[model samples]
Target chain A: MAAVALKNQLNAHIASMFAAGFLDKQFQELQILQDDGSSPGFVSEVVGLFIDDAEKITGLIAGLLDQPVVDFDKVDALVHQLKGSSASVGAQRVKLSCEQFHSYYEAKNRDGCVMALALLRNEFYDSRSKFQTMFQLEQQIEACS
Target chain B: MDRRRIRVLLVEDEEIHRVVARAVLRAAGVEVEEVENGAEAVRRVRESGAGGGSGAYNLIFTDKQMPVMDGHEATRQIRAMGVATPIVAVSSDSLPPDVQAFITAGANDFTPKPLTKEKLGHILAKFGLA
Candidate 1:
């Protein structure tokens, strides 16, 4: 099965974090932010919020492709949101690409966004799965230990 | 000069951020290597692994926003591939929760810009590299 083939990838990273003796402060806090209401599943709630934001931005960016010259200024706002949320999670390289994409938007240049998109897609695509796995693994590891 | 200085790999997309990080790290006695994007960062790591040197990258300081590969994905990719190089997230986003998330995402530590001595020192100390 697909799950069986993909051996847990975050084991070493999590182990290293424990070895370093640092708690996952940001994730814990983000959990608090999402759980301000103390809902049933706080962590999922926050990540879901982020996912919704990602969906809207993706749709917005996609819609721009149909325009005459692709008003980059309009797209820049979406890029900023993507950049901010990603950066909030310390997605540095993706944020940097978005920053560049935002600046280049003023010149009405589309190439920068394209390149930034490649990086952003790679960042989100990789992070969503890996982070989710890491979180679940962390929970399992905690339960076991 | 002495063994005190650390070798830092900086992968960033913005010119100003690169300059600022370089200055901050240099002031902290770190020798910085600059790369433009995530693609180059991965290539550099691979090259370093293929007998390029001791295959040691003391610190990898990256910006969250980049073009070819953003900081988070690059960090995730590097970790997923089993690179031991300690990565530190450097960006302008100062939200504490976000900083924590960066660490959770497998960054050795996190620092937001404009790089201050306190933050840089704290991060370096967290990794025991200061």
Candidate 2:
């Protein structure tokens, strides 16, 4: 019963993520990939990788932004990578934030870029927290099973 | 693994993307040979071609953007070598123009990033591997 409840919670959280536009069909594709006999932790493994990549890219973006003269091209490249990775995992909000960041990056608008970076940072953490919660529920269910 | 298993050459710089793609392809019983960038991909293809069938690969999947040679350039190079294997461009940029650019270069097909088993299967089937 505990496992069943945990499973329900996981499912509900995932459904809410989609409903909130925090995730999309691409995420469902990840789930389907996991359903095959590939690896039980396929989704978590990939998501963990995304988090790691995002962290490094986030650091790069910060460093670039802090430079005396901002290099919009450099920042744009990092954000582009982040956007793609986020989209792959179906992190819709983060992907959208990245798109905004790209627009500011292209215009070479420092203030706008800064604002966009903050929004992207916030969305990244928010999405990471929700993903962590979902993963925790999954682990609990797996442990009980 | 079967000696006669179908094989694919995957070129991706991102570790996570590589891991996910390898898992999906391997799960479907296909052999995967992974390389980090387009340059390495072209080299591998060249090596295989020179060896006269030792490195026979059924298909190739490359990321559009990378540190070294991008997918389009790599595709053009491989095509120039007379390597007839199907080349598929996998990128996060799902925009029509971006995808069309890769096709124009030499990619036989284009699939958006976060490749799934179903999408991989679709690509394989399109090439008659399925």
Candidate 3:
């Protein structure tokens, strides 16, 4: 693809991500991740990590509510990692979950923490594969450009 | 154990999902006791998971979200109260992170929504209780 066409495609994906509430401010920060024109894998790696982080956060939340063991730090780390990765992915809703998860934990609000956990569930549940598909397309545009 | 008479709890809040669960699980040759809310499920299981009689239920399939008591809270409470029943959660709400939520809340495994026989069987097999 021509550089101009690739850039147009990239802009279009960013727009879709914004409309879907899957990409926002943090992704903007990531848009400039290339240092002296680094590999597009920078973004791909970050997006891959976001998926892994989502899986881990699931574990941490379970630990939080489990009996005979409540692993707060596990939950916290998962949320923190999710925040960083989603920010890089420009996943708006995931980043929002991370933010709220941290806010509740810091406040020592048990109910809030639980609520945030549920909210996080909804964010992922609500995100269709199309959202990720869009992200992948953007990755392609970056590479081709 | 008689395959046709094993007691099983169907924990779900959605009416349509509950009906579907009942039809599918029962067809598999297990007696299913359905509960629409998590709090009620915990209560039912507490009275049932004691294993005093031969008719006791050994398994459960619960939905993740609901009013009054979500699956996570119900699972946590049931485990804390000594119900040793293996729980298999089936919900649209199941994700990798949510699986951890279910386990932390005392569920044994997670199955994605639009439950399938293969997934259900797989969950039962995981605990060696199939």
Q: Is candidate 1 or candidate 3 better by TM-score?
A: 1
Compared with the true structure, all predictions reach lDDT values of 0.64, 0.86, 0.66
Ranking by lDDT: 2, 3, 1
Ranking by DockQ: 2, 1, 3
lDDT of 2 by residue, A36-86 (tens): 664588889889988998889988998888888998888977998998788
Between prediction 1 and prediction 3, which has the larger DockQ? Answer: 1
By summed lDDT, which 10 consecutive residues of candidate 2 chain B come out lowest?
A: B47-56
lDDT of 3 by residue, A37-103 (tens): 3435454555555566676666667667654545566666567555544544567797677777887
Ten contiguous residues minimizing lDDT sum, candidate 1 chain B: B47-56
Instruction: Specify the CAPRI tier of model 1.
Output: incorrect
TM-score of chain A of each: 0.63, 0.96, 0.64
lDDT of 3 by residue, B1-130 (tens): 5544567888876553554455446545557888889999878876764643322676888877677998889888877777777887776544488788888787777776535445556765675556
Indicate which candidate wins on DockQ: 2
Question: Considering summed lDDT, which 10 consecutive residues are worst modelled in model 3 chain B?
Answer: B47-56
Model 2, TM vs. native: 0.90
